[model samples]
Target: MARIRGYVEALIAELRALDDGDVWMLGGGRLQAAFLERGALDDIEIYVMPEIIGGGVPLFPATGLRLSPKLIETKALDKGCVYLRYNFS
Candidate 1:
């Protein structure tokens, strides 16, 4: 996988200029939240495990922000993993 390391603002600026292809942001909930807030996120794809771990990081934190995503697709993978795809409308 290719990687680019830079300040958050620079990274988001570069991401905003892309007109084609998919950009995948790995991990870092804070960064993801920033991108979502800046209108840089197109779709959110997540993998859900069966077991519940206590005190895990929140996907959408409490900032009075709301997103209405349409459920586009779902897949049940091996080892009780569920893949969900949501299109932000």
Candidate 2:
């Protein structure tokens, strides 16, 4: 666990040093949550579809961590989908 944390820290540092544009993580909720927990993620973008599944993976896992990010923008897409953007402030 410690080694993995070190690796994540290094990766975040490297990305920050680049001074590039946004970094997108097309990973699952668990992976995103990991970065969020480490204060590495500045913002998050979520896409909502118009389908209902009985059971599936959550957008963000239950890690006993709670946060209230400011909603930056919202766009309605085709097929009844919506895009949500939130920033950690």
Top candidate, metric lDDT: 2
lDDT of 2 by residue, 1-89 (tens): 78877888898889889867989887778778888998889989999996787887778889998999999999999999999999986
> Clashing pairs in model 2?
none
Error of 2 at 17 (Å): 2.3
How much is the lDDT of residue 86 in candidate 2?
97
Clash totals for all candidate models: 0, 0
Q: How close is candidate 2 to the true structure, as a TM-score?
A: 0.84
What lDDT would each prediction earn against the true structure? 0.76, 0.87
Supply the TM-score for candidate 1. Answer: 0.75
RMSD of each: 5.2, 1.7
